[model samples]
Target: SIHLLYTLNIFEFSNTWSLTYFRPTVPTDLWDAIREVELSWAFPGHWLPSKDPVKTVYFSAGRQQWIETCGAVTRMKGLQSFTLHLSGSWFCEPVEKIPVFLEPLRDLHLRQRWQLNLPKQPYYVKEIRNIDGDLRKRGIECSIRAV
Candidate 1:
Protein backbone atom coordinates (compact mmCIF):
# COMPACT_ATOMS: atom_id res chain seq x y z
CA SER A 1 0.00 0.00 0.00
CA ILE A 2 3.06 2.27 0.04
CA HIS A 3 2.47 3.00 -3.59
CA LEU A 4 -1.12 3.90 -2.82
CA LEU A 5 -0.09 6.24 -0.02
CA TYR A 6 2.78 7.68 -2.00
CA THR A 7 0.44 8.25 -4.91
CA LEU A 8 -2.12 9.58 -2.53
CA ASN A 9 0.41 12.16 -1.41
CA ILE A 10 1.29 12.99 -5.01
CA PHE A 11 -2.38 13.06 -5.87
CA GLU A 12 -4.61 14.61 -3.19
CA PHE A 13 -5.45 12.44 -0.21
CA SER A 14 -4.22 14.53 2.71
CA ASN A 15 -7.70 15.83 3.35
CA THR A 16 -9.35 12.44 2.91
CA TRP A 17 -6.76 10.32 4.70
CA SER A 18 -7.22 10.22 8.43
CA LEU A 19 -4.34 11.49 10.62
CA THR A 20 -3.65 8.08 12.13
CA TYR A 21 -0.94 5.45 12.15
CA PHE A 22 -1.60 1.69 11.97
CA ARG A 23 1.93 0.29 11.67
CA PRO A 24 5.40 0.74 13.13
CA THR A 25 6.36 4.40 13.54
CA VAL A 26 9.80 3.94 12.07
CA PRO A 27 11.89 6.54 10.26
CA THR A 28 12.10 6.98 6.47
CA ASP A 29 15.55 5.41 6.31
CA LEU A 30 14.30 2.35 8.16
CA TRP A 31 11.20 2.15 6.02
CA ASP A 32 13.17 2.55 2.82
CA ALA A 33 15.88 0.15 3.95
CA ILE A 34 13.25 -2.43 4.73
CA ARG A 35 11.77 -1.95 1.21
CA GLU A 36 8.27 -3.05 2.22
CA VAL A 37 5.84 -0.77 4.03
CA GLU A 38 2.29 -1.62 5.07
CA LEU A 39 0.02 1.38 4.79
CA SER A 40 -2.94 0.76 7.04
CA TRP A 41 -3.93 4.36 7.83
CA ALA A 42 -5.96 3.19 10.79
CA PHE A 43 -5.73 3.79 14.53
CA PRO A 44 -3.78 1.35 16.65
CA GLY A 45 -5.44 -1.13 19.01
CA HIS A 46 -2.85 -0.83 21.79
CA TRP A 47 -3.51 1.57 24.68
CA LEU A 48 -1.30 4.56 25.57
CA PRO A 49 -0.74 7.20 28.20
CA SER A 50 -0.28 10.98 27.88
CA LYS A 51 -3.66 12.67 27.50
CA ASP A 52 -1.89 14.38 24.59
CA PRO A 53 -3.02 12.43 21.51
CA VAL A 54 -0.50 10.81 19.11
CA LYS A 55 -0.68 8.81 15.90
CA THR A 56 1.23 5.54 15.61
CA VAL A 57 4.35 4.86 13.49
CA TYR A 58 7.00 2.13 13.10
CA PHE A 59 9.89 3.40 15.22
CA SER A 60 7.86 4.12 18.35
CA ALA A 61 9.94 7.26 18.78
CA GLY A 62 8.30 10.63 19.34
CA ARG A 63 7.73 12.76 16.28
CA GLN A 64 9.90 15.49 17.80
CA GLN A 65 12.84 13.09 17.50
CA TRP A 66 12.15 11.94 13.92
CA ILE A 67 14.93 13.94 12.20
CA GLU A 68 17.48 12.77 14.76
CA THR A 69 16.26 9.18 14.64
CA CYS A 70 16.24 9.17 10.85
CA GLY A 71 19.82 10.37 10.79
CA ALA A 72 21.06 7.79 13.30
CA VAL A 73 18.96 4.64 13.28
CA THR A 74 21.59 2.06 14.28
CA ARG A 75 19.63 -1.10 13.49
CA MET A 76 17.21 0.69 11.18
CA LYS A 77 18.89 -0.24 7.93
CA GLY A 78 16.24 -2.15 6.01
CA LEU A 79 12.84 -1.99 4.44
CA GLN A 80 9.93 -1.88 6.84
CA SER A 81 6.67 -3.76 6.53
CA PHE A 82 4.42 -1.65 8.75
CA THR A 83 4.17 1.81 10.36
CA LEU A 84 1.89 3.54 12.85
CA HIS A 85 1.96 7.17 14.09
CA LEU A 86 -0.15 10.17 15.07
CA SER A 87 -0.11 13.44 13.09
CA GLY A 88 -1.05 16.89 14.30
CA SER A 89 0.21 20.30 15.44
CA TRP A 90 2.40 20.18 18.50
CA PHE A 91 5.01 22.48 20.03
CA CYS A 92 6.92 23.83 17.05
CA GLU A 93 4.96 25.01 14.06
CA PRO A 94 5.06 22.55 11.13
CA VAL A 95 6.89 22.99 7.85
CA GLU A 96 3.73 22.22 5.88
CA LYS A 97 3.30 25.94 5.15
CA ILE A 98 6.37 25.69 2.98
CA PRO A 99 7.06 22.72 0.71
CA VAL A 100 8.48 19.36 1.74
CA PHE A 101 12.04 19.33 0.44
CA LEU A 102 13.50 16.96 3.00
CA GLU A 103 13.49 13.19 3.02
CA PRO A 104 10.49 11.03 2.21
CA LEU A 105 8.07 12.26 4.83
CA ARG A 106 4.62 10.78 4.48
CA ASP A 107 3.09 12.79 7.29
CA LEU A 108 3.83 14.63 10.55
CA HIS A 109 3.07 13.26 14.00
CA LEU A 110 3.45 15.58 16.98
CA ARG A 111 2.02 16.98 20.23
CA GLN A 112 2.41 20.47 21.78
CA ARG A 113 2.87 20.68 25.51
CA TRP A 114 3.33 24.24 26.82
CA GLN A 115 5.52 24.03 29.88
CA LEU A 116 7.84 26.72 31.15
CA ASN A 117 11.35 26.49 32.61
CA LEU A 118 11.99 23.10 31.14
CA PRO A 119 15.51 21.77 30.51
CA LYS A 120 15.56 22.70 26.83
CA GLN A 121 18.14 24.88 25.13
CA PRO A 122 17.08 27.60 22.71
CA TYR A 123 18.36 30.92 21.53
CA TYR A 124 15.22 32.54 22.88
CA VAL A 125 11.99 30.88 24.03
CA LYS A 126 9.31 31.97 26.48
CA GLU A 127 6.79 29.73 28.18
CA ILE A 128 3.78 31.05 26.28
CA ARG A 129 5.50 32.52 23.25
CA ASN A 130 5.47 31.30 19.69
CA ILE A 131 8.52 29.35 18.53
CA ASP A 132 10.16 30.59 15.36
CA GLY A 133 12.94 29.35 13.07
CA ASP A 134 14.28 29.50 9.54
CA LEU A 135 14.86 26.43 7.33
CA ARG A 136 17.69 26.53 4.85
CA LYS A 137 18.88 23.64 2.72
CA ARG A 138 21.58 22.85 5.25
CA GLY A 139 19.64 23.56 8.47
CA ILE A 140 16.49 25.07 9.94
CA GLU A 141 15.49 27.50 12.72
CA CYS A 142 12.69 26.22 14.93
CA SER A 143 10.73 27.46 17.93
CA ILE A 144 7.50 26.73 19.79
CA ARG A 145 4.48 28.79 20.74
CA ALA A 146 1.20 28.00 22.51
CA VAL A 147 -1.33 29.05 20.00
Candidate 2:
Protein backbone atom coordinates (compact mmCIF):
# COMPACT_ATOMS: atom_id res chain seq x y z
CA SER A 1 0.00 0.00 0.00
CA ILE A 2 2.75 2.41 0.98
CA HIS A 3 4.80 1.47 -2.08
CA LEU A 4 1.84 2.01 -4.39
CA LEU A 5 1.07 5.39 -2.86
CA TYR A 6 4.73 6.40 -3.12
CA THR A 7 4.93 5.29 -6.77
CA LEU A 8 1.72 7.10 -7.65
CA ASN A 9 2.90 10.30 -5.95
CA ILE A 10 6.22 10.19 -7.77
CA PHE A 11 4.59 9.45 -11.13
CA GLU A 12 2.13 12.34 -10.75
CA PHE A 13 4.74 14.89 -9.65
CA SER A 14 8.04 15.68 -11.32
CA ASN A 15 11.36 15.35 -9.51
CA THR A 16 11.50 19.05 -8.51
CA TRP A 17 7.85 19.30 -7.51
CA SER A 18 6.49 19.30 -3.99
CA LEU A 19 3.95 16.97 -2.37
CA THR A 20 1.59 19.64 -1.14
CA TYR A 21 -0.98 17.10 -0.01
CA PHE A 22 1.37 15.65 2.55
CA ARG A 23 1.09 17.90 5.57
CA PRO A 24 2.16 17.76 9.26
CA THR A 25 -1.27 16.39 10.15
CA VAL A 26 -0.38 13.07 8.52
CA PRO A 27 0.88 10.13 10.55
CA THR A 28 4.52 10.40 11.59
CA ASP A 29 5.66 7.14 9.93
CA LEU A 30 3.86 7.92 6.69
CA TRP A 31 5.14 11.49 6.58
CA ASP A 32 8.69 10.20 7.12
CA ALA A 33 8.28 7.72 4.29
CA ILE A 34 7.05 10.46 1.97
CA ARG A 35 9.97 12.71 2.91
CA GLU A 36 12.37 9.85 2.20
CA VAL A 37 10.77 9.36 -1.19
CA GLU A 38 11.01 13.08 -1.93
CA LEU A 39 14.66 13.13 -0.93
CA SER A 40 15.42 10.11 -3.08
CA TRP A 41 13.64 11.68 -6.05
CA ALA A 42 15.50 14.97 -5.56
CA PHE A 43 18.91 13.26 -5.33
CA PRO A 44 18.82 10.10 -7.41
CA GLY A 45 21.95 8.29 -6.20
CA HIS A 46 25.07 8.80 -4.03
CA TRP A 47 24.16 12.25 -2.74
CA LEU A 48 26.24 12.13 0.45
CA PRO A 49 29.91 13.15 0.45
CA SER A 50 32.45 10.42 1.17
CA LYS A 51 35.10 12.54 2.83
CA ASP A 52 34.10 15.34 5.22
CA PRO A 53 35.28 18.00 2.82
CA VAL A 54 34.43 21.33 4.46
CA LYS A 55 31.25 21.17 6.49
CA THR A 56 29.90 24.15 4.51
CA VAL A 57 27.61 23.36 1.55
CA TYR A 58 26.58 25.85 -1.14
CA PHE A 59 23.00 26.05 -2.47
CA SER A 60 21.11 28.43 -4.74
CA ALA A 61 17.39 28.20 -5.43
CA GLY A 62 16.17 31.01 -7.66
CA ARG A 63 12.49 30.18 -7.33
CA GLN A 64 10.51 30.28 -4.08
CA GLN A 65 9.27 26.70 -4.62
CA TRP A 66 12.79 25.39 -4.98
CA ILE A 67 13.76 27.21 -1.80
CA GLU A 68 11.02 25.43 0.13
CA THR A 69 11.95 22.10 -1.48
CA CYS A 70 15.66 22.49 -0.70
CA GLY A 71 14.84 23.60 2.83
CA ALA A 72 14.09 19.94 3.66
CA VAL A 73 17.44 18.87 2.23
CA THR A 74 19.16 21.40 4.49
CA ARG A 75 17.53 19.90 7.58
CA MET A 76 19.13 16.52 7.01
CA LYS A 77 21.68 15.31 9.54
CA GLY A 78 25.44 15.97 8.95
CA LEU A 79 24.80 19.30 7.18
CA GLN A 80 25.88 21.71 9.91
CA SER A 81 27.03 24.62 7.76
CA PHE A 82 25.66 26.24 4.60
CA THR A 83 26.12 29.13 2.16
CA LEU A 84 23.03 30.40 0.34
CA HIS A 85 23.95 32.03 -2.97
CA LEU A 86 21.20 34.33 -4.14
CA SER A 87 21.11 35.60 -7.67
CA GLY A 88 18.51 37.78 -9.45
CA SER A 89 15.91 39.72 -7.50
CA TRP A 90 14.84 37.12 -5.00
CA PHE A 91 12.69 38.83 -2.38
CA CYS A 92 13.62 36.92 0.75
CA GLU A 93 11.74 38.13 3.81
CA PRO A 94 14.63 37.80 6.26
CA VAL A 95 12.77 39.19 9.28
CA GLU A 96 9.73 36.90 9.25
CA LYS A 97 10.60 33.83 7.21
CA ILE A 98 14.26 32.87 6.70
CA PRO A 99 15.33 32.38 10.32
CA VAL A 100 12.62 29.85 11.17
CA PHE A 101 13.12 28.00 7.89
CA LEU A 102 16.82 27.70 8.70
CA GLU A 103 16.43 26.73 12.33
CA PRO A 104 19.26 24.86 14.09
CA LEU A 105 21.68 25.83 11.33
CA ARG A 106 24.98 26.26 13.17
CA ASP A 107 26.94 28.08 10.45
CA LEU A 108 25.28 30.09 7.67
CA HIS A 109 26.75 32.36 4.99
CA LEU A 110 24.48 34.75 3.10
CA ARG A 111 25.85 36.13 -0.17
CA GLN A 112 23.64 38.71 -1.78
CA ARG A 113 23.54 42.43 -2.55
CA TRP A 114 19.87 43.09 -1.87
CA GLN A 115 18.04 45.70 -3.94
CA LEU A 116 15.53 47.10 -1.53
CA ASN A 117 12.92 49.79 -2.07
CA LEU A 118 14.18 51.93 0.80
CA PRO A 119 17.90 52.11 0.06
CA LYS A 120 18.48 54.61 2.86
CA GLN A 121 17.00 52.34 5.53
CA PRO A 122 19.53 49.54 4.90
CA TYR A 123 16.91 47.05 6.11
CA TYR A 124 18.76 44.07 4.73
CA VAL A 125 21.95 44.94 6.59
CA LYS A 126 20.09 45.62 9.81
CA GLU A 127 18.09 42.41 9.49
CA ILE A 128 21.20 40.39 8.79
CA ARG A 129 22.95 41.94 11.75
CA ASN A 130 20.04 41.19 14.06
CA ILE A 131 19.80 37.63 12.77
CA ASP A 132 23.54 37.22 13.20
CA GLY A 133 23.36 38.42 16.79
CA ASP A 134 20.41 36.17 17.55
CA LEU A 135 22.05 33.15 15.96
CA ARG A 136 25.34 33.90 17.75
CA LYS A 137 23.57 33.93 21.10
CA ARG A 138 22.31 30.45 20.22
CA GLY A 139 25.93 29.50 19.35
CA ILE A 140 25.28 29.65 15.58
CA GLU A 141 27.86 31.44 13.42
CA CYS A 142 26.11 33.53 10.75
CA SER A 143 28.04 35.68 8.29
CA ILE A 144 27.49 37.53 5.03
CA ARG A 145 29.98 37.35 2.15
CA ALA A 146 30.25 38.70 -1.37
CA VAL A 147 28.96 36.52 -4.20
Q: Among these predicted structures, which one has the highest lDDT?
A: 2
Q: Estimate each model's TM-score.
A: 0.20, 0.31
Off by over 4 Å in 1: 1-64, 73-75, 82-84, 90-95, 98-147
Q: What is the C-alpha RMSD of each candidate to the true structure, in Å?
A: 13.6, 16.5
lDDT of 1 by residue, 1-33 (tens): 554453233111121122223124644633334
lDDT of 1: 0.29
**Candidate number achieving the greatest TM-score relative to the actual structure:** 2
Position 132, candidate 2: lDDT: 57
Error of 1 at 91 (Å): 13
The window of 10 residues in a row where model 2 has the poorest summed lDDT is 112-121
Model 2, global lDDT? 0.38
Number of clashing residue pairs, candidate 2: 0
